[model samples]
Target: MGNINKDNLLYMAKYSAFNPYRMREREMGYTTSIGSSDALAKSLYCGMKAIATWDSDREKAPPTGGIFNLEFSPEGTLLVAACEKKSIQIFDPLTHERIHAVNGAHTDCVNCVKFLDARMFATCSDDTTIALWDVRNLKKKIRTLLGHSKWVKNIEFSVKDKLLVTSGLDGSIYTWDINSYTEYNLVYQRVFHTSSLMRCRLSPDARQMVLCTTGGLIVIIHDLNLATLAQDLHGFKPNLYRLMQMSHQMIPVAAMYDHLFDSKNRENRVEFVSDFPEGNDAEVVSALQVHPQGWSALSRNISHDDKSEWTCIHDIQPMESPCDKDTRDTSPVGRGRRTPSRRTRPRVYRVPRPMHPNPMATTHIQITRESERAAAGPSTSHQGGAPISPPQPSRLGLPGIQNDVWEAAITIKQHRLLQEMYNRGADVPSTSGYTPHQESPYTSDEEPAAKHFIRQNKNRLLYYIEETNEGKGFIKELCYSSDGRIVCSPFGRGMRLLALNSDCGELSGVAQDLSQPRLMVELGQSLGIHTDLVVSSKFSPRYHMLVTGCLEGKIVWYQPFSGESL
Candidate 1:
């Protein structure tokens, strides 16, 4: 009670309607649900229950500073942590017991660690070298591989190809052939290179690979070839857009679908990611930017917090496109110049000034009368003077007649359309014998394309306030559970285990709608599960166990199953 300040006390007291203890009971999982008595068993459990902690005794070991990365072994029997103290420590994940220690694992800070198998694993450091080690013998080093010219940032293993893949700040992807390693000559192949490589991973299926960079680009390599992109990236030609170079004249080019090589199945053309103009946030981004990423025109962002500005990014839509306006806003025009809700807005899609208009045939022409038929009669194939259709605007305009496009001429009277919906077609009412009006003028403006909002709002959630951080906060990483149910992340000082919503409620479980992800915390004013900044975390794949390390070099173990080890 004494630790609670006036503002915090007032914050907790804002909800004067309910009893505090009862709310805590439900939040701590001490109160049973209103259903069958079977739910009562869950009441005994407190979520994210702390099992034990890993910290060095001041006299026994040299002090460790901050924790950088954590990894669990493939067999789930051991865990490794890379530390800011320039050393590596091994711990029993379930018991949180320190099993082995190496004082100087690297010349500089250890950044990342991964297990190749149960007994053998690897670690990388700022010294630009990757060291392999055997768990059985911690004192002696196995072998250190040196190929990266800059700090190695990530490590991944391909079991199918029997290869060791690593990416570094040097922007090169190296694959070390494990079967052919020699002390004198290192056998590694450089597969791909980019400007700012930061992370790399092989797909679980071993069919594809991906690399992430600092400039917010994900390079997906299919068929493992650098010469041409995979056909799978091709999709229907960027909806009503032309690919163009961002140059002085903005020269237009053929859709990149099959233009790279002789592979010419132009059924699904695509636009490139570099096409979208950068924006402050997703809301203001142009919809045409959705083509390259195959989703929304989202990029870097900075969200408004309680006070300061922090970066924000949105969820991706894999196979759908999001609209800048409501679907109902697509009406041609509103009644009596009241301004239609769908009056085309310039922000939805920005066609580069030099880019060509959509590849559509601008106009159509028809024979006006029998006299206009060509002298080659048999080729015209006019059978017994069948009723001729009315003449359409000619494809080309001669000096005397102008080919024009009219803004969808309404067929019915304005009074008749008050409660009725009408079908619109290309046939002009003026051509169908209504009193012909003056020929319309030709304009350069193209009609806007109709886009739809996603059916579920869950897919388009925009987060604010909660994800803000500072300094090394950008380097801190979070991950989903092995089964992808819970999100384990380091919030400001402590860490949070957020569970996904399973119920189908309109407001997502409805008691106190924080408008944020479901946080698994004990009831009351306790914000998270710790008091110091948690800098790194790792999860066990075969069990419901989580381990995190703080800036003070204290490692905390989180487990749901109490009293026993998995």
Candidate 2:
């Protein structure tokens, strides 16, 4: 790393392509790479400059609505996208050139494109139709799937059962057998029946699926199966007003995001800021994609104020179960554990000398000794020849022919006695005679039950990242690479290449704290690349290049780190 410098720029460019955090480590002065990163770093801070590229302004084509979604081939060679122009566009991912185009493939805008395999892909459109296409022949569709009544929103493929699941605006979830295109799709009906449904996505691990709707409602189907949605299973509702309105039959961890229905200051409510002007409803999470590792999710927020578009990385961590360490602490003042021992009681600490020493009280004590000379006799003195001082009564007020201690001696003694009793009470076990750490079904212990409740109900927050750009345009898309090193998100008309500014993690994508996202490159609109709002973008899973689509029918491919034309 130290050998590669400005003098050897050619060598650095040749080998640094595979380095995941090349620009990030160069700026941060740290890396998982070998040697000191600062030695190999550049002296001048020319960070994230827009790379110069030749983009023609007169490049105009037909059916120019915009790209709705982008999907990469399983082999990472071709890129296909759903377009609002009612066509399917395919491109060579290595270059920015369009290899083939399917015009008038759908009656309405294509909403989503998903590759089934290397040679096959599926697409859904606003015309309520799903088409299966073959890469060998891009001229026509292999099969046209027609079952949805309204606009189809999303398409999910289950590799285990070889099924294609799709959801639509008509409030229906259908699963088609990909093995047999002639078979009719099965509509699984249970708790999910709403026209407000926006999109549903299966988790990367395929263990569960989350459904996001227009009413700020996010329903999760746990242990997801085709028959799981049709089963009559009871759901567990947490303590959140208007957030857990379940159908009472489906097992859903439901939570609402709308402030109009939810309490203004609800504790532990995981929701995004809403900006939609719709009537008492907002699609807070405009874009949602689970991390490929399946531990967390990446969500893009919808905002009317373009600059306030926030992106968050939510991690799903399992809550810790009840443990004995909490009940094993030994502190006495304020602790749960109760060990009955007073080795350092008040007696261990001596009370201070009285503030006001009375000389007349001392003289009176000497005079009383002479008066009781005959009364004391020989038995007054102890066996060791030391005379004992009798306990004084509270009735002996100041100057009552007795020892008159001035610093409220009676009150001090009473306080010590009360403290001892309070200590004993704290050590006392429950009526069932079980220790606090011991489990007792009949005992009144709410702590253990509360812990179990929290374990089941709580969703641990991993990290949150927000965009504070006070400029125009919102982030309509976020593309996370399959290699799990970078997260590409669009800001305004431009696009930003962001990486998790945390520890080096190659295996788990979103497992670390991603609160602080570092931007490596900015392909700004002023750079003569994407001149319009970047509505959709995709990262080459194996390569370090990114392709973005804008509203103006202009497509730009960029190298994520150097911001160069691909």
Candidate 3:
């Protein structure tokens, strides 16, 4: 089996454009080419292109409402979309064919859709409910979760803990255990935010969360691990009131920023380190997306006009750089770049010592004599020989050895006097000695006061889109590929892809020509589906495929790398 896997890997390296080993080598600064042809070709492989489009039947008066969300199965086999109407559609990504459509899934518009596993998925609706459905049996819904009193805006599932977290417009957040498919039990609830909750997302490690509100507030809650909470607090249950009280002392350290209301008080406000020029008018941040690598993209309304939306991407400088070494040998000489030297034959030698007498042996001798006396019959004299006095103390009575060759050495008479005083438990005669508080004989200069340095944040903005569609269309969603190579967004009537640029440390278009700043895959223009706007887009987990949905009720599949329809 191991040999077979190795053979498969070798075959992929030889035939496929995606080369994992080559990418790693380039990242480590070991590549010999400085912008060579091969390097450019490898970079092109990371770029994206549109391939196919699947449009809804226009004559059927298809739901004119736009798609609100798009999600793909864990295996990338099926794609699902939540439409503005009370409907949920599933399509085969490989064939670009609609396999299932559930009409009247909810009483109101479906807002978000997410796949729990390969065979099960969940959708949230404006009807204040969440419905779970099995892909095999789309006609029959699996379960309905009821807790939020208002429109459910967002839902997220933690695969590690099998818990689903949902937020609603009623200013409440709830957590449900999905381990039992038949019964969805609410595990946690909180109503800490005063305004309506717009969205909630768990961090990549599931240790923190980022939440956005309709009032333009962004809140980050740290240390949100359920296991950590259960272990630290005794008899703790998932209740809103208890969690709110415990939040005052323990987990869920929160940081909030209300850019819209607090812009005038910049000095006292918690400002994110950004380089983008702040608009004269305050912008209401509506959505936030954070990448696993600490980068973030925020969508906001920069103007008074309702449709004047903007998206900005920021790069957070990591506390530690990737080049930091964990070992003492940071020199690259013996690293993978060079071969290690062979070990030579061992050589034997005799050990040499005697820098000073062992103090431990001297103490042991004294102990042995005392023990022998105790074991022997009571006698005034020593057991081994004549009565022996304790070793005489020198005039220079320090803790360790005294310098015998120096003129400061004590004479024999002085040593006898000191030994007698010690035996009698009397203080010895005073002598001159060095003290830390005393002035030095060599110099009179005073030491300098300690100095402290403050470090400033270096976070900067990588890219900004002020008017993606002439201030007409709003950004619906933002997604980063699983490999972190590309970031996609549904701007207007199409989708845009941004590739990471190594030179400028920003996301730029794939086209070399920069005259046109907007380089997007125009779905409407390419597919001739110009009736409505494209609203939702998502990337596959394991492939280069992308699925996009439009307001005209069309689900289009595209091969981003090859421009070849599947």
**TM-scores for the candidates:** 0.53, 0.57, 0.55
The clash count for each model shown is 0, 1, 0
lDDT string, candidate 2, 1-566, tens digits? 65545535543443243445666666887544432222122211112333322122434446546666788887789988777778887877776567777889898778789887899999998677788899999788887776555567688887755767787655456676666532343322223343334566776656656665433345544445654443322221221212212111111223222221222322222222212221112233556676676655666654322335556555442233365233122232222422212112111111111123333221111122111111111221111222222222233222221121222234335435544544344443447685534443533322221222111122323434455342232226676766554566765576665555322234254345334333232213223466666677777666655667776656666653444433
Of candidates 3 and 1, the better by lDDT: 3
lDDT of 3 by residue, 316-343 (tens): 3223323312211222211222111111
TM-score of 1: 0.53
Question: Model 2 off-target regions past 4 Å?
Answer: 1-61, 181-191, 232-283, 303-307, 317-459, 468-475, 502-528, 560-566
TM-score of 2: 0.57
Estimate every model's Cα lDDT from 0 to 1. 0.45, 0.48, 0.48
lDDT of 1 by residue, 247-328 (tens): 1111122223223212132222121222111222111110001111222222222221112222222333222335423212
Per-residue lDDT, model 2, residue 164, is: 78
- Please estimate how well model 1 matches the true structure, expressed as its whole-model Cα lDDT: 0.45
Identify the runs in model 3 with alpha carbons over 4 angstroms from their true place. 1-47, 58-64, 180-185, 226-276, 280-282, 292-301, 304-307, 315-462, 469-475, 502-530, 561-566
Predicted model with the maximum TM-score = 2
Consecutive 10-residue window with the lowest summed lDDT within model 3 = 447-456
Model 1: residues with Cα > 4 Å off, grouped in runs: 1-46, 222-466, 472-474, 502-531, 561-566
